[model samples]
Target chain A: MTTTEARPSKLTPRGRATRERIIQAAAELIYEHGVQNTNNERIRLAAGVSGSQLTRHFPTKESLVRAVIAWRADTVIALHKIPQLGHLDTFASLRLWADSYIEREELCRGGCSYGSLAGEALKAAPSLRPDVADGFERWEDLFRAGLTAMRERGDLRPQADPDQLTHLLMAAFQGGMLLNQAADDVAPLRDALDAALAHVESFATHPVPHDDATGGEAP
Target chain B: MTTTEARPSKLTPRGRATRERIIQAAAELIYEHGVQNTNNERIRLAAGVSGSQLTRHFPTKESLVRAVIAWRADTVIALHKIPQLGHLDTFASLRLWADSYIEREELCRGGCSYGSLAGEALKAAPSLRPDVADGFERWEDLFRAGLTAMRERGDLRPQADPDQLTHLLMAAFQGGMLLNQAADDVAPLRDALDAALAHVESFATHPVPHDDATGGEAP
Candidate 1:
């Protein structure tokens, strides 16, 4: 419920740019050092803003973190909007997505901000919950849109539930990233994606029976 | 690489109980606050030990975290040894695991301690990479063993590679956790597990035919 309510920019046009640069630095610091470990002073030093300036702009650490979460959500969720996914093979698109994920990993250095923040905030700050929670919901929508597009193009089984598949795909991708962090390697991500891609491809060769009952299928 | 090297309680039995209490307190604090964020002073306060007494028992934070990780490894990994997993229906066993995971989320409120430490450590300290990496490798191995045993029992696709499936499963689980954290809900984990269990069931029902390049219909 807390927010940066200040409507006025603290600095001039050039000063505004400086403010953004400082915010970016603070975000990076937050990503690198745990938010609790990172403080206004460290953020100021890292961002090259005066301690007074940092406080004037951010006022509180929560506001600073919220800004970062918004930015990250925008970038991570941008994948679904890239046109021409309609033409790409599912595996090709997934590989591209994987490569992009690698870029994100490098940028953050071993952890997704969402995962880290969610864990940290869950235990400490109850306020940040809404932002993180909302981000995931949006993420699911992004995937659902993409899968729906594929279904419309006949790349997916006619009876396939795009919404359900979206959940599954995102789940695996998220899990893969977590596993990659744990193993401190990317092989798990690759293996998981490869297995998933193969299954999607196999769906082309052998479709689930159209008349198959939902509940009584093999347990 | 820094070890705490606390002396085993050579003191009265009462002293041993106190030491254990102190260690447990430190673990909770470290999990709540980042390892670096938590200090001996705070730990002493939480544990009700004198600052000097806390220092006498455990000299460093790294050593305390190490102790927790070591203890967790022994206890949590032992959970993987449940036999006859292959004999259980995929749905039944998966539901059990999934439910346990949800329960964990409820308990931690934030996520997982092992995951949190790995994320924080890998980001801030490069030296801890080895410990974090080794720990996850152990986790992956446990998963691999389960998949392997199940495959041996004909509970998996004939050509399913246990290692590959293990990776996929791990990825899904981790990814789901991330999504769970982001959404502040259990849907991601639940949805992903549902897909995985469904995929296995779908796959087991239709094994791919062996190639007969010799122009003979081989049974």
Candidate 2:
């Protein structure tokens, strides 16, 4: 379904607020209990909206789930603030970005929000795969833009591929989070990011001095 | 729950066969449709076993899920045949191992079987986290053993940390497969693995000749 169909153009300010409230409630419920277990009734109660209101905003559960996917994508990008930072062209900024993700207590505990939603969507609602895929593509694009900037600025080798590197970084982050979820530890996440960053560092046009790079004492 | 508790000691040959059939059926069901969607009745029907027989083997759904996790771990190792090939000491063997996983059609379609189950189990059955973690630990150990062999054989640098590298490899794999599932494409999986392999290659004591390594014509 298209965005216009899912969200009618006739919404007043109050109607928009109500819709946002419902979507927020549904997103949290789905995050905690998964898509299969979270029903419209539960969402309605959680949102403090009536069944009719819920139905008015979302014609079907699929539409609501799609809305949640879209909402989550926006929320994730906002939370990352990568777009706000503009370009992650320098190695230090890249390291900072990686560290910011690693240091998040919520990620260590609950795993990546996008990944959790995507995982459940893949299983319970196969039809929504495109929406989930769109979310990931958007997220990857943010990184790809930064990496592209690096390549153009000559911080990366002339032949270094920003697109491929973006995929590698995203995979490492997603995979590390998955492992973290399974192991109930953050070490896997840390190690995975470290390895990916090292790989990226290998492509630096002028490698950072070892001591400056690692912050380690002189050998 | 402990293994001994999950699987009772006393069972005749027929009873054992029934149990195996039930687990195999449950595993397939879980693979095709996640843990939340696959019910005991469906598994029983698929296995062609009576309700009583199913209950006798796995009194609880949790027990059966655990059995599936155990079965999946074993099946994944056997399928890889890495242990049978002994050490992945040489870079060529490592490349072969990575290629074998990438070339699998089932992986392209269904994603990594073990990863799909783990993803579902993480969301649907939080208590089964330990079982999933144990399965991953076992899988990582297989890779760690190979890396350790490479280091001991002087193919890798003396200071190379097998444990950390194993984490990176496993993270890339799980992450790559997760991306593959979301994108419905194998390129992400390939890119992730290629990046991880390149990272691993950086540790080689005597780097494979560029021409011999990549099989590309001379520059």
Candidate 3:
């Protein structure tokens, strides 16, 4: 099933707004109620869209789920505006990025958007695993970019592998988010991020004399 | 709705087997299809139980869900019979425990059972959140016990607060599990566990002079 990209380009601006509204409402409903409990009919009612409108945007539940996955992934990546995420040249920027996620978790009182969908969708919607995996790949890319920048700038030691570290950081962050969701606290996330950041910090190159270069301290 | 404890004491061996079958079937079905996609009829069919028999054990879907949560929690904890978890007295035991989980993640081809359920059920089954949270607490207690053992043995430094480190380890493990689920690989889990174990190793105290005490190597 096609997602937003499948929409006809001949639509007016109002058409675009309505389509977005349906997706937004569906995302929130799915987020709160889960994919199985939330159906297209409920989405129609919640989105203030007619049956035709809902169908026009998402012809099937699979299509709608795919759209939600894409939409949520984009929203998550876009919201985390930081250097290492976008540039990834330092430990300080990585910490700032971690803080942003922790703060959002506090405000939202939910796990990662992609993760929530994934836990529900992976088994039930086997076809969409790649889409969810793609979302994660994109996230890893952000870290990879930052680490690459650090490597180029002579900040990271030669032994540090950005690709492996990127995977490690993403996994650590996802695991911490899961624990935080279960405990309804940020301690899990904080620890996981700290550990990951510290691992990355362990690779810092020391240019100064007799300097201890492990970036273990949280910025 | 009540859980397994609510069952009558007069049940024969056959009745007991049937009840266990129903829960086991429900857990597998839910694990593969999610709670929403798998229904009472499917569960009954899978368990080879009659409608009345299913209803006799779990009067409501919520009750069945609660039973599943309780059953799965016990099963997960019981299966991981390692140090700290089985016996948490040394860093070697912890490494062994980490290796066991990484292996299980590969065998199961899914994330941590508790973590997957927590993500999907936290919002959909808010009533069950505490049950899930309680499960995590039990897991954390295992870690805490291990850390406390290390401290008492003079393996850990005096500054290591088992409680805080317990929370950190749990969170890091959970985050890494989530990433592994998304990516369908063990690298994330390995990385996260390594990071956590290394951090824990950092807290080790050396009683012997001129000894390198950080138990950083994976067993």
Candidate 4:
């Protein structure tokens, strides 16, 4: 694991709020335009921070990226416990997750924040890579656990590889997101996810019977 | 398809060669550093072009990216028909096709040039999306074509959905690449590929007879 260090900074209460504002702006920008394409000046302008104030909080772009990743990490960790994932319909579970992903993109038109950060940090900030690695694997674990539960219920093929399926699902999600950012329309994502979920459906050993109880929505 | 008009300026022989050199260098840099991260100055340095000369040829960062994508599209379209894809060991075929994907990543660290360019040009270059769409669909075509060939030889289950399997394989390949990029290693690729191939192997309905002269790869 790379030893990541946040740059030193001090902020008053109002300053801290301003700093948070800067990060929120940065997160939006970085997700859409990508971290490398965005400049500190732009970030300062977006956050309504003076030049001195921006540097006083985050001295480097990398630090700003780390803050976004940390904040995103909190969201992912909070909403995506294994048990919580287990309770939702696979389609609905995925759409809820897509909320953060889609909202972030519209906010900045950047690629994914964690993905963009990880790509930038790959060479520039090695310390941040482990956080990226750990974060991605955590999502993989959640998917694997959820799939395992479904399989135990005799929904999936006996030989279905949960870990592999997890990787496939995550890949399509991110790849679709990446393409959607490029294309600016959400159609690629819709196609990729629809295709992926359809593949998941086919792998079930037993045909998925239609639920007659409250068929329109999940309780 | 959106028309992204890059000013490919008319050049003398020397100027043409230099422009090609710059495009090649930018391709390599984008592969390593990502599309947005590699700047005109870095591009100039890498291509051994003076800053003035680089800007003379490519007025915008987007122009340089456009040229790189044009260059790579040639490389990406290298899928000459392989008549024996199914008969060959699955791993061998995958390895042969996987190189450009990896090299493509090195050129555009976070994405395929198709992915990156279409992303940037989605609104401006709708006409160009098909090229990007083709790249996305190519892997599935290969997998589907291979499975169809296998079926002709009575090697696949009669009920197997080659089209769906191709989509699944495509997702797995893309996903595995994402994991490989994040992990900064090839092992995940190997592991993930192995697992997917195993799933494909399970669909083998007929054992290869020893009498076939070219079928020794599978046990």
Candidate 2 CAPRI classification by DockQ: medium
Q: Interface RMSD values for the candidates, listed in order?
A: 5.2, 1.8, 3.0, 5.5
Q: Quick one: best DockQ, which candidate? A: 2
Clash pairs of candidate 2? A175-B175
Instruction: Provide the overall lDDT of each model, using Cα atoms, as 2-decimal numbers.
Output: 0.62, 0.80, 0.75, 0.58
* lDDT by residue for model 1 (A1-219), tens: 655534335557876776677767866777676667777778778788787777667677787776667666676667555763432335456545555665455533456655665555544556777877777678667667766666677767665565556666766666566567666677666666656555554445344332222111122
Instruction: Report the error of model 2 at residue B1, Å.
Output: 3.7
- Which sections of candidate 2 miss by over 4 Å? A1-8, A82-85, A209-219, B2-8, B82-85, B209-219
Angstrom error of the Cα, residue A167, model 1: value is 3.2
Q: Docking quality tier of candidate 4?
A: acceptable
A31: Cα error in model 4, Å: 2.1
> For each candidate, C-alpha RMSD in Å?
8.4, 2.9, 4.6, 6.6
Off by over 4 Å in 3: A1-5, A8-12, A82-86, A103-105, A206-219, B1-5, B8-14, B82-86, B206-219
Superposed by TM-score, candidate 4 places the C-alpha of residue A156 at a distance from the truth, in angstroms, of 4.9
Q: Model 2: how far is B40 from its true place, Å?
A: 2.1
User: What is the two-chain DockQ of model 3?
Assistant: 0.46
Per-residue lDDT of B1-219 in model 1, one digit per residue for the tens? 545555665666777777777877866786776566677788788889897777766676666666556555555556655663432335355445555675567743445556666666665566666777677778778666766666776767556666776677666766676567666677666666656654555545345232243111112
- Candidate 4 C-alpha lDDT tens digits along B1-219: 233333456567788888889999988776665565578778889899998888878776656666677676555544434553333334346444444344454533454444434444332334445545555565346567777877666777775556545544554455555566667665444444444454555567754332233212222
Better of 1 and 2 by TM-score: 2
